[model samples]
Structure formats: structure tokens, C-alpha cells
Target chain A: SQLAEENSWALSVHEGESVTVNCSYKTSITALQWYRQKSGKGPAQLILIRSNEREKRNGRLRATLDTSSQSSSLSITATRCEDTAVYFCAGMGYKLTFGTGTSLLVDP
Target chain B: EAAVTQSPRNKVTVTGGNVTLSCRQTNSHNYMYWYRQDTGHGLRLIHYSYGAGNLQIGDVPDGYKATRTTQEDFFLLLELASPSQTSLYFCASSDPRWGGRAEQFFGPGTRLTVL
Candidate 1:
């Protein structure tokens, strides 16, 4: 079973535009990690925000965590065609449980 | 650089046939995990291990068995393969020493087809 709900299954954005992907989880977690998977490849970690931290940033990627609401969001600024992929949010416990995922397509 | 690899990259097997998926990590991480990915469902964990000879059942462990032969090697076994088990399998490794917030590194993934 998936522990989180991603806002969209597919999203399209023009290059250089900014886009945000929202995720909502059902249970408490020690941390929330975002991952990106390109076609024909496994997922790669984007960012990990601990429960104690409200936000984290890596390059153009920003992740925000709100424990009270059990939600997290990932924002990518200045999107590029290379940024097109399926993004997943995972809630960490003894093991990381992944959400359905948001497929983002950055078109030039 | 941290790296995890799995083999065979793709496989086709018949129902009731025996299948084994292998994973090896060069990162020397203490934690290794196996997961399967389907179209509608994201990724579901099948099993994990904290160290050599240790095994922990994951959320979706039915019809699957795993063994951690060494710190760097893990194998998933399907004694009787079924069509429903056809999916892309991924292998990941993480180190807990990183303040309990280590990020997982994943392999390219193995595509398995059970006919």
C-alpha cells in the first residue's frame, strides 16, 4: 500500500518555468525523501527533509515538509527538458514506502 | 562513488519456473533493499537486510523470498514464478551511519517477465 498521495499523475510545464509537486501522507514519519526516475531507469534521490526541518534545497529542487499536516511539496525552478521524469515522495519508517508518483514533462 | 548493480538486466521465465534476482552494492552500505515497480503502483518493498545473513520482511513479501549472503550481496528468489509477479525490480543500498537520514542509491533495475 502507498503511504502518500501525489497531487497529479502527469504534469506538463514549459522549459524555464517553475513547477511544484505536492504529496500528502497518512502517517507520522521520521523523514520524507523525494526521488526522480527517468525513463528506463531506477529512481534517484532528490532531497531528504527530516521531520525536524521544514525545508531543504538541492540546486533547483526545493522540498518542504509539514508534519502537522502530514504533507510535503517539491518545487523545481527553471525547469529543463532533462528534468522531465516521474517524481516520487517516500515516507521513512523502518523502511521507505513510496507514493504513486507525479510524472513531470518539461517541454522546450 | 556509490553504486548498486543487479542482474540479469532482463529475464523471461515461465510459470512454476525457478527465478533468482541478484543485487550487489559496492558502497559498503549496511542496509540493502529490494522493491518491485508496477504501472499504477509506485514501488513496493519486498525485503531488506541490515547486514550479512540478516533478513527483514517488507510490506509486499508474499510469493517472494530473500537472502543476504554478504554485506554487499543480496538475492531474491521466486520458487514458483507467476505472471502476476512480472514487474521491474530495483535494488537499493543505504548507510544508517549518516545521522539516520541516509538517502538510498538504486540500481538501473531488472525487468522480469513471468509468462
Candidate 2:
């Protein structure tokens, strides 16, 4: 079983729309990280929110961690075609467990 | 700039052939990891090492072997190549909490195809 799992497999939204991707984990984590993967590229870290922190923002991206619920969310504001990619949330401690990921397509 | 680089960015080999993928990290981090990515399964850890000459098993380590020869290099080996192993391979290096850093840097990745 996957330690972390994303809510949706794929999402499509027009440019300028807002999008959110959710993730749930089976075990407790020291921190949860959000990563973005473009086509033919490896995953890149977007945000890292610790267990104690509830929310974090990086430019157009916002991430919220709910340790009580064992879930997290990544929100992209004013989406652009350049923002299109697969987003993954990973739980980290001694080891990192990643979810299947949510593929976001921002159509122009 | 901290960078992780993988060699033989693309490869094609026949079954039963021996293959070796190389990774180098210039960041000199203490932790290095190997992962394979598939369409529906995302990225799964194969192996990791904390420092030179150290190895640790990950979630999916079956039929795979890893060696960390130096602080800057880690290698993944397939003694008998199988089609099931055909996938994109990524090498990452991270500074462990003990090293006082929380970020992992990823390489460009290697695309291997076993026929």
C-alpha cells in the first residue's frame, strides 16, 4: 500500500483558474513536501510544510498541512499553461513515501 | 549550484545483459537515493545510502543492487536485465537533518529500456 495517496489522477483547468490538489497519508510524518514534475523531468520540490505548521506559501503556490486529519493540500493561484505538470505530495521522516500524484493541465 | 547528474541518460539493452547506471552528486550531501518512476505508480524508492560505503533497502528493492563507493557517487546495478525494470531512474542527494539541511536535489534522470 502507498503511504501517501493523492485524491485525483488528473485535473484540467483553463488558464487564470485556481486549482487545488489533495493528498492523504497512512502514517505520521515529520514533514510533508509538495513536488512538481514536468514532462520528461524528475520531480522538483515545491513546498515543505512541517507537521506543526498549518500553511505555507511560495509565490503562486500555497500548501496546507493537517496533521490531525493526515492530509494536505496544494493550491495554485491564477494557473497558467506553464504551471501544467504532475504534482505529488510526499511524506518524509526516516524515509520518504510519495503518492501516485495529480496531473494538472492548465489550458490556455 | 548543487547538482546531481546521471550518466547514460538513455539506454537500450537486451534481456540478461548486465547494466550499470551511474550517479554523481556535487553537493557532497550525506544521503543519496535511487528511485524509479512509472506511469501510474509515480516514484518508488529502490535504495538509499547515508554515506560512503553504506547501503539501505527501500520499499522496492527486489532484483536490484546498489553500491555507494564514495561520498560523491552512487551506482545502481542490474545483473540480469529484465523488461520489468524498464523505467525512468532518478538519483537524488540530500543533506540529512544531522547535516542540518532539509532539501533533496534530483538529477536529470536516466531512461532505460530493456528488450
Please provide, for model 2 over B2-114, each residue's C-alpha lDDT reduced to its tens digit, 9 standing for 90 to 100. 68999989999999989999999987798999999998998899999999999999889997999999999999999999999999999988876643225678898999999
Off by over 4 Å in 1: B98-101
Give one digit per residue, the lDDT tens place, for model 1 in B24-97: 99988989999999988999889988899989898889999999999999999999999999999999999869
> Would you list the C-alpha lDDT of every candidate in the order shown?
0.92, 0.91
lDDT for each residue of candidate 1 in A1-108, tens digit (9 for 90 to 100): 578779899999999999999999998889999999999998999999999999999999999999999999999999999999999999986557899899999999
Q: List the TM-score for candidate 1's chain B.
A: 0.96
Candidate 2: clashing pairs of residues = none
**Where is model 2 chain A poorest over a 10-residue stretch in terms of lDDT?**
A89-98
The CA lDDT at A3 in model 2 is: 80
Q: List the residue pairs that clash in candidate 1.
A: none
lDDT of 2 by residue, A33-105 (tens): 9999998777889999999999999999999999999999999999999999999999886578889999999
Model 2 misplacement above 4 A: B98-101
Q: TM-score of each candidate?
A: 0.96, 0.96
